[model samples]
Target: MTRPAHVLYVAWGFPPARGGGVYRALATSAAFADAGARVTVLTAAREAFERYTAVDAALEAHVHPEVSVRRLPFDWPAREPDRARWSAVRRAAPRVWWRVRKELDRVSFPEVGYGPWRRVLEAGARQVHADRAVDLVVATANPYVDLVAADVLHRDHGVPYVVDYRDAWQLDVFTGRRKHRRGSRVDRLEGRLMRDAREVWFVNEPIRAWHAEQHPAAAALMHVVANGYDPQFAPAPRLEAPDPARPLRFGYIGTMSRQVPLEAFRAGWAAAAARSAEVASATAHLWGHSSHYAVEHPGSSSIPVTPGTPGTPSALPTGGSGGGVVVHGPVSKTAVAEVYAQLDVLLLILGTGRYVTSGKVYEYLASALPVVSVHDPGNAATQVLVDYPLWFPARDLSAEAVATALVSAAAAARTADRATRQACADFALASSREAQLGQRVSALLDAAR
Candidate 1:
């Protein structure tokens, strides 16, 4: 007659919020629900996603029916584009207004856009706890403000909390540099939070090590929980032998941020096409949003591509050398499998960073397709793919290096047998989302007992 452990999962980005971190949040919550925990999620309102970022309505279906989600109203004045709603000060002396706004926000918490949300989240957490006692609190961060709710509950009710850092609060993952000065509000706040946390989780060992170095006292509590592919969203491995007559399809998924080496990829694709007949006939598909936001504006970093006619590639400029490049825009999470199924090769083009390991890498591995990694060799993702049988990593981001990798990937696509594809898929089985979250969930629940 024992009741299920009540778990409070706080995340800034959830389903329909088309950010890169949304997938991990979705899968983590779902994993908790599947583990028989009474899961409740706190996230921003649907309007926030619809207005500020792009929304994927289809992803809503992925949420487990048993899990309850409560959306809180978020105030993000910085991202507000509607000038009509702005005050005179914001319209006239915008810089001064922003400076004042940031100062006011930091009065409550150290973060700018998210600091003001601390009180709102605390109130929400208190209200949730009042209804039914929360057994454990798990807070995922980017805005890092979500951690405040967990901290509030822990301080007020003696509840244990877990801080799940999707990225660092004080360290810039891309540059491996400290974002805040010593003794600053951010540093003090992060130190206090980590010191009080029951456990702190990071996406990779590098990030964990970095945080451990910063917080030696809490080093023993830190753990690595890598981002793994969700089985429901991953495409089945393409086991069929390649038909030389049909052109191969190379694809890239996830956000195309400003840091992504798109120009290098373009040049490399063209050069690879000129050198290899298989690559010459192949088409490259770019899926997902261009930049972090879906709303297109003038001078945006998004690559311009005409909407393609059915059964034809989009009119994307390839310098008149390579195979056609098509921009399919953002694909729905529900339709991920379908899009990935059509791709013969997965392109892992990432920004240069030793700590950058994208979630899409797991999906690419699961696809069992030949992967062409057009990123820095020093990237953390390279380590993950080093043992991958079908991975073709570029030596560098240069056009020649990328072209070489692309050509090799193309060759693999044409010649790789079903056994080789299966072996690659087998290698990825250990990295499934369920596999990654299962032990963690059990440990947390057991601790709650």
Candidate 2:
């Protein structure tokens, strides 16, 4: 009998770590296993997620039984002592110790929080390779330290590796700015990995194009592997329009990161109410962790904005003016479908950029709800949702433009028929993660041959 191709998958955020990139990481592992590869995943300990980032116990139920996950120690000395089991010194003065510890960690490895794990991960890869011949090593990055392990396995054991860059390491996606100086440690490391990698994968075309332009020699190896929505979270398409009498419910489910322009969204919602009767009664519900640390810790931070920025209306909600926008805290994955079912319009709020296509946008597409895009017109998501029939893009980031879009979207939500609903569902089905990753996995296997 012939042995199956052995794949060593490296990712820092896997199941239980409910971060945005977790879905991509989890799906990649399943795709490799589904393609008949013997897959093994190396990731940070579950405790690390519980102590720092929020955890989604629901995701564990979805992981394939064939895949083996190995967890290594990852102590986040930055976050305050939760129920985590760590040293008293680390628990007491995290702010003080983190600064000192982080500096030393960077000296050994270029990555900040994850740099110290370099030795353990490299050793883990070597150990996995020794147990059985590893035919391929696929590493996903945020820490980018995973590339070090991939490089080590390739150098020591002659295993070909792939770099799955969920996001760019040296390029800021939001601003299209260079994050590292030329010929820096990160620059040298990135160059080495790209040169050595068998393939380089990116989530979107713009990101791939940017990398290709930066490294012309490695451009041939670059491939676009988009992040598609998981079928489990999407509710059945709503064929009926929402009741005209009741207040329209606009929903957004994702992290409320610093990049999110909530002030503009709030301003727009208020403006829509003032301008249109159909929108006046509308309520926007934000359902997700405010920030990664918001759910687990106290004193969660928020971005402060000027009283009235251009395009931003001054009528504040309650604390400043009235009540309509509600911020619901994070919910479990099991409850995600129910949340979508309750909404009439989906608010697609995002940062401004040509390279920012968030994974949530795909899930929003799957919901089959009327979408009000509260973002810069130049965002990459506009490219994805251009053909989506239910989409109502804002003219600009200004409050008045967003308000107009919101009002239009509210009307669309109340008038959408069966045909419109089916079209949205069809759009989602076409970009299903199974279909997206299946093609990539098949291509990867063929390349390995």
Candidate 3:
């Protein structure tokens, strides 16, 4: 306890970037600060946040000002001007430019758009460590390039590092499929870097098990630290639900990514509404940016949707989603709870099953409201919500199955038992992001020597 381990935290989506990773990273950097460590966060520029994902000024308000945030320029090709200098392929046509860039991006790193930012990140990590010597470097991977940065810092500076795999880097978690080619160059690199990591953190048991099975020895160092709710985003005084005359208001909060089965969501929604006279009495609400809503974009094999404005939902059968599924757009973290107050039920939807334990789940559970699982049963969110007295879990993609679950969850919503409410509250008590990660970093620091 005499000396706290200085963690040079590297994350791409720190606060102000409303990407889900921001919550975990913000909570993490702040969590380290709470543990009495001097935390210097090296991240990409705020402008980058606005471009890659929706900008969350409200999220910026909750960031721990005590933590020193140093953001490097993250200017990428996508955000670049001077197409005049673009290679012939990129300069040819808008369509060709996208393909050319996609190819180049994959050549740079497995992730799109972000793969090329690796050099800046590595330099930032090393530069932060140089100006202020750090005992340990804890890098959270999403672009997964942070691992490369941490590896560089450790290799060059001997700063012991921890690689927090909020989600697995090699596994196609959604499909329960693996991406790594055995003994492939990427595989060897991942294995080598993780080999010397001081610690590794995962968000849930399934992901932990997958990583453990893949890197059995690393399991000793691996820890499963679930994504906890951010206290700042926790629901406040319950807002009255829309009038009973208004349709049942179910809501989803987070990115409208293509990976998400938006069509499936539409199907389930239509099925539920058509079957239940109650649905005629209710509407669905979606909060967040749908730029990546797979269905909204073409070329994606996911269900296709005609894309247009941001506020409207995809076109649905009989009743268009724009009318039935009202998108409120991205809310400030401060206003999140107010939005939750408007919902009779929360929709838990994500790109990947099980491996996905949405940071919002904690906040959702904390709302003490009924949640409808629009996700896989294997998800960590389910693990957290399963114990909650009021959750109705949807186990499959079947519209009938989802409709039934929604009905059940809706019924539970009307007369949510007091015990259920309290249990929801108690369930989230320790799940506060700051509290959870504070405990985690404290222990990691205690054993660091």
Q: Identify the leading candidate in terms of lDDT.
A: 1
Residues 339-380, candidate 1, lDDT per residue (tens digit)? 777778899989888888988898888988999998888888
> Is 1 or 2 the stronger prediction by lDDT?
1
* RMSD to native, candidate 2: 5.3
Instruction: Return the TM-score for candidate 2, rounded to 2 decimals.
Output: 0.91
Model 2, span 320-419: residue lDDT tens: 2144666656766656777788788999999888899999888888888898899988888898899998999999989999998998998898888889
Q: Would you list the C-alpha lDDT of every candidate in the order shown? A: 0.84, 0.81, 0.73
2 or 3: which has the higher TM-score? 2
TM-scores of all models? 0.95, 0.91, 0.86
User: Order of candidates by TM-score, top first?
Assistant: 1, 2, 3
List runs of model 2 lying over 4 Å from the truth. 80-99, 294-322
A best-first ranking of the candidates according to their lDDT comes to: 1, 2, 3
> What tens digits encode model 3's per-residue C-alpha lDDT throughout 308-393?
23433332122235436654455566677766766778888766566777778788877877888887777667777777766887
> Any idea what lDDT model 1 has?
0.84
